[model samples]
Target: MRTSHKMDPVSLTGLGLGVISLTFQLFSGCLKAYNLLADARGMPAQFQYLRIRVRTEQHRLGNWALVANLTEQSGSLSTSLQLNEALVQEVLREQETILTSFWKVSHPHTLMIDDPKPGPVSGTEGEADLQERVPQSKSSLEDRALRFVEKMRRYPSRIRWSTFDRERLETSISQLSALNDAMMSLLDSQQQYKFHQAQIRTSMQVLHLNKKVDHLLQLFQANSMQLSMAQFSQNLRLLHSMQLSAYSSEPQEERQTLATLARFKALNVEINLDSDDERSNTSTGIFEQPPLDPRSCTIFSSVPSSYSPEEVRSDGIYENIPVWIEWKYYEPVLHIGHVDPHTQVRISRLSALLSNPQKPTQFHTPSCIGYFNDVSNYRFGLVFRRPIDVSSVGVPSSLFDLIISNEKPSLSMRVHLAHTLATAVQYLHSTDWLHKAFRSQNVVFFTNPGDTDISTPYLCGFGLSRPAQNTEMTEQPDSIPLYNLYRHPLAHSSIAVDGKSGFKKAFDVYSLGIVLLELALWMPLYRVLGVDDRNLQRSLQPGVTKKVRELLLRESRYLEMVKASAGDVFADVIRACVEGFGEEGESLHDKVVVRLETISI
Candidate 1:
């Protein structure tokens, strides 16, 4: 029986085919599972990267929209319109390219290994090939997207538009429209993929991506509106300028010019211009001309009388405005030595808001008095509302000076100062601003005529201030030792995963903590830590909390001074800040305020 059981060729072939089919099915299933796992792992990171990219793009788009609007509004559209429009089209094209690439990398085809031939056996090897290929494809896509984003960041500089070249404009528009179509297609595919994904988390991530895309679309719509407004403003300015020039050239055109001016007035357009004589004069002295009407002024040529030429520090220039300090009327004023075109626009906008009679005063920072420009330099001034002569109060120039003084401030005085400091910070936060350069030197002491319990602390030095929504991160130089001392350790360290150097509220809190520590211990940081300027700089090289703790613990005198002066609650607040508490979210500010309020003194 065994000898007669030799298998026929047909049976053997059929058996072999069945085994191959089974193996093929198993291999196919494994490949599908592998792809799913890979996607599950990779998609979240990709989405996160996409989110950052989108945010950056939104910021760039907003900036461009602002530029376009300002140019149009200022009647300079002819000079910039072509370039700006081309820029917009370029960004849109790049965005579409990124989306297309994202879709391809995120949605690879499912493996199919159903062939019954021996050639199909290579599909098993293909699985390994696919695994290797998918990652390479994803990585290449990411690299391309990143490079595109960087190119977009620098795209503004590359834009060269010639008004005579209608072909270029047409090409740009056509490219943009084609990109729009591609983006829509990619979106549709993403929607399909999202619908098919089984995991809730993955689906949610897809939903997030959809929201981001929708946001981008909304931003594009906003850009269009901004462009329109700019164009309208530009037209108005041009008409007014033309009418004025004609009126000045010919007395007979006076009536027509007046009528045109009246029409502009009816439309609420401002037509104020400097007199010819005023424009012709050239003076760069601190006080070359009388200040503008104080009531309507947003900048002044004044400062505290105590301010000396030596006290004048240059903060470089912003928008071509050379910023410096000067003395006027016994108060320290921020003096803009040159009010460039950009500065004029900002001043005009701010002046409009300040001119509103019903505007709330609580949210306002220091007020400006007036601005003037000689032929050589433009000047504007910001007057400090509260000016303190630290010398009058038996203290030095600033809170920093008081900290280093051998004389210790009373605990009650310390409490009042801390409360005032917290309140000022709370006020700034409420007004949606961050005092990025918050430090003891920035805090000035002012005594109210009748109130004598404690000197009022005013948060001055707004040179580095910015909106909370758009905080800036700056690199600290080795020469700027003050920043090194007051800045959050995380700011200098590489621990932040976000790679952000911008100041945060928590960073403000940390700076406040150091100030409080000085206030509490009644000693400068360098003195309390028993370190020289060199050691102080070195100490900041380590982690903030650990380094601070070591410095506090290493010196018994520091503990004694803090405990003896500020007590436990104040000490705890300082510790919490040093530990990086209250660094995030809206609630942290409230929490800090509550914590400060709870402190008895």
Candidate 2:
């Protein structure tokens, strides 16, 4: 697929009467010798290095062919290379002779004739004759070479390379390498430089593709293993169902119905006929929160807190307080974080949009009553109406608290939490907003004062949340390293160095990636990095985000832990989020929500 440009042709003349034709014949001989070695089978592992050497030499020869313009249709190179013909011809002949040695070592039973006929001419007819004989001469040489290769192919496969042939093969390669060097030396400096540059570019491209292939292979192998285990379990359940059908004392109809259900379940299918019914929908409503339209939501500004000052409980849950706004009294939980001292206007607008009571009920997040300013502390709080599902619990605990307490959720619970958080993010992005402060601490579970519900994770910590359309607003990086641990490196600066340097959707995805990592490893950010809070807090400087990013990227242990705890599929999703979904074709819903749904305990 690579394109080549025309270059000055080397002159090959006065060395002999028919050296040009002889050089072409020798090139054909080299091609034949390369094929003979390449097609050989039953080569021992000890001499596999020889096979690699053959390939390298073949590539070099091909480059030489391209540089010399020998493969071009115009044949301009052949006409110009009439000066110093004998020296070039001798170098080609020597390379051909060395390559032939490989054939003799591998296929001793086959006989080959080394004969070439080069037609020489004088004066004006010489150039025309050279061009005319180019095709005929090449064909004659190729035919003889193919016949020799065909004979060698017919030899028995039982014969193979041995220790004795090692020295001969290496020596042949070295001699051809020397002759190749000689041939390249005759070319102009520009041609050699261009050839080497092309070779380097080719190598780097091949390396990049090879890494992609290797990663795909690892994914394939991991999936294959999981599929095999799943299939085995399904088979066992099917067998059990068959036994029950054969021996059960129940009625035939009932037994047949049970067997059919078993069969469907074995194939991972649900047979729920009333899946669209209200009852079925309500049962699954907690995970299917509808997305709210920001345009439809009302923004309330300067709604002061109606209650006395209340600090966060020791359990890290805000006390439920009465928030009286717009002539309505509603009791909502306060999820608050510190904000920039100057951005009161932006915070007020975002809270008003989220807390609009007319907005649809958000199951994965609390409905917002309105924004309440804590003037005493200069902190703004987002007042969210208690979720119906969590109404029975006293207060909710953050994921950070649960993780440090060592409350390890079951694999199924963790999977559900991951799915819910991913969906929450997708919904937020789809609704034209960004949860810029997304992290484990922001994710809360509504449960008893001392207990945690890992299954239902609500995304919180929206103090920094903003609309995606508002690109004019700049982001201030969090002072605490713990908060910035989940943020993208590009978003660590308040100053937008470029379009990507500012906070974007990918930054939100990066935060989601880190939260998923917490779910995967069941550890807080500090513990995952094997550091304490004091040490993490000490890293309050420029480029801290990049430093942490580099640490995570370089640490294979985190990925290993994810795979061990959550399996291959979950690890892959985490990788995509952390690294980012490469192209914009797939929405976060497809890349995260849909992929997480496919994963089972």
Candidate 3:
């Protein structure tokens, strides 16, 4: 080239084109690599955002449910309160009118008249004085009667009468009657005109009228006092029933509505009460986004790094054999608070037992990896052999949501879930552990990649679990009545009647019965019973145990509905579990597992 050798134009052009093509290839490859790196870096942040969104949606749904319940309570309370107020007003008005009329009729008036001196006087002068006095007295009596009638025409506004005031009014009426009688006697004794007998009779009739008015006034006063007391009592009861404070200008109904709205707003739920269609649409959009991977998310960055060597083993060994790492990052799922030393020991023992592959006990449940203590905050981490989506785990969304959204699960899936739960309970019982907090909400579902056979069911709510003997000795009565819907009626009734905690293996079996019924009917307990959470709460009050027991019995409408929907086999299992067969040496969990195994999908 230095020598300036002459080159072909076509060859020079081919060389330039080839250089350009190579440069373009290098640039494209670099861009793709940069994109891959960026995605990898952003995944944690994206996962964190997804978790936040899922939590926000769950809070929104919870607030919406609360709002629905409050709205119902407001409607019922408003109707009853309004009716009671209207009736009270009507009775008050009628009683006031009666009292006013009686007061007017019994009112006293003053009269003036001239009389002759006590010394004897001439007959003509005495007769003149008497005639003048008679006319003046009659005119005064007529004027007083007119005034009383005019006063009676107006209704009385301030009619508050205490005992003293009532007595004074009665005395005044009696005095007025006595004065009328005296006036009538004076008129009857008048000799000015014997032919005025008709006038005398009219005066006597007026006197009799006074007596009648006095008697009526006394009766009205007594009746009015009784009515006032009755009204006061009724108002007190209404106030109690409304449960509203005197200082609050807002009605209970409005206050509850506002609180519900505020809660919805706090949860980031955009609700428009003006449009039902809009609300429905908004609710449907609540959980539209897919859940994030809890393991890869940075939300658990606050999780402590300190872990036992056994817990930190990266080889992922079960019985010394390698297995898939279901969970990559350890994170706290619940804040259990400062656990008792004994409880901590029990949990540690349980965790070790679960991780020991040498043990014959094996079930489809989450394995407790390890526990951490941060001051008063105690937490534990769990791991599964295969990764799972935590966002779709809770009962409100996984199980209840299916029924709420009108999505029916297949018969086989229900059977499988029921069988898995029974097996898990059986395993726990076999280990002499009691799951004191067993419920549908404690059951979780998982999915394994490339494994489309069946959804994995895990029994995971072991926060309240302990050795059977320990739980029996330290069991506390459940304070939440909503949970009682799943508990055995006898357990609830016995506790209510005797103030004792009736926690036993049979209690768990009864809860299983409720869950099985739920699975069979594809409905939540509240929905099946056609009641709200408030109704369930009210059912826990004193004297309501009997009624609740009757409602939960085998012949109750709830069971009848379940039997109609799920068939005889499922119903029989529920009945047997709920009403234990007093057989000795046979655990309820074992019986339940046996019954579940025999049921065909």
> Candidates' TM-scores?
0.38, 0.43, 0.38
Give lDDT per model, in order. 0.38, 0.50, 0.38
358-378: candidate 1 lDDT, tens digit per residue: 322332333333233322332
Residue lDDT tens for model 2, 1-601: 1111111223223422222334454455566666555434434434443554454455556566656655312233434344545555555655655555443545463333222223322223212122221112223434553453343223222222332365455555554544555555555766665455433332222212221112222222211221234443543453243221111122122223222222211111111121334122112111212223323333333323211123331111233432212111122234554444335555555555554433322326666655545544444455555555455433356787778775687888889888888766754553345678788877777676556567666666666665444454445766666677777887777765134434677888888889899988888766787766566666534565567667776788888899999998898888888878742313565667667877976
RMSD of each: 23.3, 24.9, 41.9
Badly placed stretches (over 4 Å) of model 2 are 1-342, 358-363, 388-395, 497-501, 539-544, 582-585
Best by lDDT: 2
Candidate 2, residue 298: Cα displacement in angstroms equals 24
Q: Model 3 residue 572 lDDT?
A: 72
Which candidate number would show the highest TM-score if scored against the true structure?
A: 2
What is the lDDT, from 0 to 100, of the residue 91 in candidate 2? Answer: 58
Off by over 4 Å in 3: 1-339, 359-362, 374-406, 447-454, 471-475, 489-502, 533-549, 583-591
Model 1 — TM-score against the truth?
A: 0.38
Tens digit of per-residue lDDT, candidate 3, span 23-50: 1122122222211211111122212222
